[model samples]
Target: MKIAIIGGGPGGYVAAIKAAQMGAEVVLIEKEYIGGTCLNTGCIPTKVLLHSTEIYHQLRNEAEDLGLEINDLKVNWRNLLTRKELVATQLVEGVKNILRTMNVEVVRGYAKFTSTKTIEVSLTAGGKRSISFDKAIVATGSKSIIIPVPGHDLEGVITSREAMSLEEIPESICIVGGGVIGVEFANIYSNLGTQITIIEMLPELVANMDQEIVNSLEEALLTKGVKVYKSAKVLRIDRSGKELQVTAQLGDDPFQVIAEKVIMATGRKPSGDGLGLEEIGVKVDRGAIQVDRLFKTDVDNIYAIGDCTGGVQLAHVASASGLMVAELIMGERMAMDFRTIPYCVYTNPELASVGLTERDAVMKGYKIKVGKFPMYGNGKSVITGNVRGMVKIIADENTGEVLGVHIAGNSATELIASGAVAMRLEATVQELITTIYAHPTVGEAIHEAAESVFGRAIHIP
Candidate 1:
C-alpha cells in the first residue's frame, strides 16, 4: 500500500516511519520543516528552556541550601539561547536522519487534497506533483490562539513561539492567560528574576483543574512574587512608546498594566490552515479535523491525530495517536486507550497526574477515598530542603481500586508512570501500601499517600 502522511510532528513523522516499517511505501509531506511544531516550537523547545532556567535558578538561589556557595550569579541570555538553538537543531537533524533511514519518502511541500484519494503537492523547491495513496494520515497540529483585542498587532505582543525564542529575556512580562503555557512561562521568568504578572480570565489558575492543585500552585506562585490575578478579562492592548499597555476588566472601570513584553497564551486551536483538507470534502469541526475511534476521519482511508483531532493537545497523546493510526493501517487492529494518560505542568514543585481527579470522580458520582502525603513529611523532601508539595491519590472506597494520583514536588512527572500503570491495571490502595518503596526517595511518598487513605499515615495525621 502507498500512504501519504502530512505534517512531520511527533504524530506525523512517527506515523510515517511506522507505516514504512510495516512494508508499505510511505511519503511524508512537510511544507515547512520536518519534526513540526512540537520539536521546533512547542514541547521540546519550551522544555529545553525550562531545564536551563531551572539550572540557573537552582544554582543561584538553592545553592546555599545545598551547601554550595557562589557569588554574583548571573544569567547569560545569549549563550543560553545559543545552547537551546543548538539542541533544537541537533534534534531536528536527528529526525530528518531517522526519516531517511526509515525509507519514508520525504517530500518538502504543501499537501493539498484534490479529492478523497488524490492530493496535489506543491513543492517548496518550486514545482508541483500529484500523489495517490491508499491511506493517508493528517497530523498537522495546532497553533497558539491570539485574541482579537485591540493593539494586538503591535510590536511587543507575540505568541508562545516568539516568547520561547526571545532575543533576550524581557525586563517585565505580562502573560495574558494563566493556563499551562502561561503559567509555565510565568514560573520560568519569575525564577530567572524577571518581573511576571499573570492574568487569567478564569477564577483560578489552571481553572479546569482540581481546586486543591490550583491552590497549591497559587500559593507557590504568590511566594515566588508572581503577580497572579484571576477572574479578570483583558479589554485591549494599546502600544505606547516602548511599553505595551494592557487594559483589562477591573470590575467596573478598566485598569491598565504596561509591560516590556506580552505573551498570549489564551489557548491553542487546530492548525489546518492552508493545508487544503476542505478542498477535498474532509470535514473539520471548528478548525479541527474530526476523527473516529480508530483515528479514521469521515473520508475513508484517511486519518487524523494529535492537536488536529482536539482531544488532548499533548505530545504523548499525539505520539500515541500517530502510532495507533499507523498500526491500524498496517492491517492490524489497534484502539487508542486513554484510560490513564499522564499530564504534567512544569513548575517549581512540578504538577503531575494520571486518570481522574477527586472532583472528577465525585462529579461522575463515584464514592471514593483520598490519600495525601505532604513533602514536609517525607524524609527525602525534608533532607533535600525541597519540602514544598504533596502526593494525593484517590480510589474507590469500597473496591480499593486506584482512581487517580496527583503529585507536586521533585520528579513528580517521573513518579506518575507507575501511577498511570497502576490505574490502568486497577491496582488498589491496599496493594500500593503493600508495595515496598525504598526509603529516602520520592517513590516512598506514593506508598505513604496510600497509607493516608485509611487514617494510618505514619508521618502525618
Candidate 2:
C-alpha cells in the first residue's frame, strides 16, 4: 500500500512515519519546513522567547527576596532571537532525519490533487513531480488571521509571525485578540519590559478556559503592569506622530492606545486553499476541509486532519489524528478519543484543562461537585515562591467519576496529563485519592483536590 501525505507538519509527518513503519510506501510533501507552524513559527519559537523572558522577569523581580543581589540586568534581544532560531532549526532537522531513517520519501514541493488517486507537485527546486498513491492524507494546517481593519497594512502593524523575529523589542505594543496567542505574546513582551496593552473583544481573556483560573492569570498580568481591556473591539489603526494609535470601542465608549508596534493575534483559519481539494470532489466549507470521525473526506481514499478539518487547532491533536488515520489505512480499526485531549496555554503560571469544564458540565444537566486546592497550600509551590493558582476538579456528585480537571500554576501543563489520564481511564475521585503522589511535589495538590470533592481534604483547613 502506497500512501501520499501533503503538508509535512505534525499531522502529515507523523502519518508518513507511521504508515512507513507499517510497511507502506509513504511519500511526505512539504512546501516550506518539515515541522510546519509548531516547530517553525508558532509553538517552539514563542515558548523559547517566553522561557528566556521568564528567567529575566524572575531575576529582576525576585532577586532581592531570594537572597540574590544583582545589578543592572538587561535582555539581549538579538541573542534571544538567535537562540529561538537555533532551537527551531534543530527540531526541524531532527524531524527530517527521522523521516529519512524511516525510509519515508520526503519531497519539497507544493501539492495539488490531479485526480482521486494522483497528486501533482510544483517542486521547490524547479519543475514538477506526480505521485500516485492508494490513499492520501491532507494535513494542510492553518495561517494567522488578520482582521480587515483600516491601516492594518501600515508599517508598524504585524502578525504573530512577524512579532517572533522583530529587530528589537518595541517600547510599547497593543495586541489585538485576547485568546491563547494574544495572551502568550502579551506575557512574553510584558516580561521583557515592553509595555503591553491587550485588547480583547470578549468579556475576558482565554474565554474558552475555566473562568476561575483565567481570573488568576489576569491578576498576575495586571500585577506586572500589563494593561488589559476586555469587551473591546478594534475599529482601526492610524499614525500617532512617531507611533501607531489603535482606536477601539468598549460598549458605546471609544478609546485609543498608542504603541510603537501592534500585533494582530486575532486567531487562525484553515489553510486549505490551492490543494485542488474542491476540484477533486473533497468537500470544503469556509476554507476548512470536511472530514468524518475517521478523518475520511468525501472521497473514500482521501483523508483530512488537523487545523484544516477545523476541529481542535493544537499540534498534538493533529498528530493524534495522523496516527489514527495511518493505523486505519494499515488494516487496524481505530478511532480518536478526543475527550482526553488537553488544552494548554504557556503563560506565567501555565493554564491547562482536560475533559469538560464546570460550566459545560452544569449546562449539560449533570449534578456536579467541584473541589479546589489553592497552590499557596502546596509545599512545593510555596517553596518555589510561585504560589498563585490552583487545581480544580469537577466530579459527578453521585458516581464520584472525575469529569474534568483544570489547573493554573507552575508545571500546570505537565501536571494536567495526570488529569487527562484519569479521565481517559474513567477513574473516580476515590481512585485518584487512593493513588499516592510524591510529597514535596506540586502534583500532590491533585490528590488534595480529589479529596476535596467529598469535603475530606487534608491539606487545607
Candidate 3:
C-alpha cells in the first residue's frame, strides 16, 4: 500500500511513521522545515522563551525570600534566541532521523491534489514531482490569524511567530486577544521586564478555560504589573513617533495603549487553501477541511486530520487523530476518544483541565458536585513557593463519577494527567479519594479535593 501525507507537522509525521510501521510505503511532503509550526515556530520556540523567562522571573522575584542574594540580573536576548533555535533544530533533526529510520520517503515541496489519488509537488529546490498513492492524508495544519484592522500592516505590528523571534525585548507591548497564545506571550514578556498590556474582547481572559483557574492566572498577571483590558475591541493601530498607538473601545469609552510593539494573538485559522482539496471533491468549509468520524474526506480514499479539520487545534489532538487514521488505513479499527485529552497552559502557575467544566456539566443537565482545595493547603506547594492556585473537581452528584478536573498551580500540567486517566477509566470521586497520595506532594491536593466533595476533607476546615 502506498500512502502520501501532506504537511510534515505533528499529524503528518506521526501518521507517516505509523503507516510505515504498518507495512505501508509512505511519502511525507513538507513545504517548510520539519516538525511544523509547533516545533519550528509555535509551541517549542515559545516554551523555550517561557522557560528562560520563568527562571529569570523566579530569581528576580523570589531570591530574597529564599535567602539568596543576587545582583544586576538582566536578560540576554541574543543568547536566549540562540538557545531557542538550538532546541528547535535538535528536535527537528530528531524527527527527520526517525522518519529516515522508519523508511518513510519525505518529499520537500508544496503539495496539491491533482486527483483523488495523485498529488503534484512543487519542490522547494525548484522542480515539480508527481506522487501517486493508494491513499492520502491531509494534515495541512493552521496559521496565525491577523485581524483586519486599520494600521495593522505597520512596521511595529506583529504576530506570534514574529513575537518569538524578536531581536530584543521591546520597552512595551500591546497584545491583542487574551487567548492561550496572547496570555502566554504576555506572561513571557512581562516576566522578562517588558511592559505588557493585554486587550481581550471577551469578558475574561482565556474564556475557554475554567474561570476560577483563569481568575488565579489573571491575578498572577496583575501582580506581575501586566495591564489587562477585558471586554475591549481594538479600533486600529497608528504610528506615534517611535512607538505604536493602539486605539480600542471599552464599552462606551475609548481606550488607547501605546507600546513599542503590537502582537496580534487573536487566534489561528485552518490552512487548507492551495491544496486543491475542493477540486478533488473534498469539502472545504471556511478554510477548514471537512472530515467524517474516521477522518475520511468526501473522497473515499482521502483522509484529513489536525488543524485542517478544525476540530481541536492542539498538537496532541492532531497526533492522536493521525495515529487513528493510520490504523484505519492499515485495516485496523481505531477510534479517537477526545474526552480524555488534557488542555494545558504553561504559565507561572500552570493551568490544566480534562473533561467537562462546571458550566458545561450543568448545561448538559448533569447534577454535579464540586470540590476545591487551595494550593496553600498543600505541603509541596508551600515548600516549592508556588501556592497560588487550587484543584477543582466536579462529579456527578448521585453517581460520584468524576466529570472534570481543573488545576492551577505548580506542575498542574503534569498533574492533570492523573485526572485524565481517572476520567478515561470512568473513575469516581470515591475511588480517587481512596487512592494513596504521597505526603508532602502536590498530588495530595487532588485527593483532598475529592474528599472535599463529600465534606470530609482533612486538610481544610
Residue pairs in collision within model 1: none
Listed in order, each prediction's TM-score against the native is 0.97, 0.99, 0.99
- Over the stretch 241-299, how does candidate 1's per-residue lDDT look in tens digits? 89889999856766788899999999999976566777676778777887787878778
lDDT of 3 by residue, 16-122 (tens): 99999999999999999789999999999999998999999999999999788999998899999999999999999999999999999999999999998899999
Taking all chains together, the TM-score of candidate 3 against the true structure is 0.99
Identify the runs in model 2 with alpha carbons over 4 angstroms from their true place: none
Instruction: Summarize candidate 2's per-residue lDDT along 7-120 as a digit string, tens digits.
Output: 988999999999999999999999998999999999999999999999999999999988999989999899999999999999999999999999999899999999999999
Q: In model 3, which regions exceed 4 Å deviation? A: none
Error of 3 at 63 (Å): 0.4
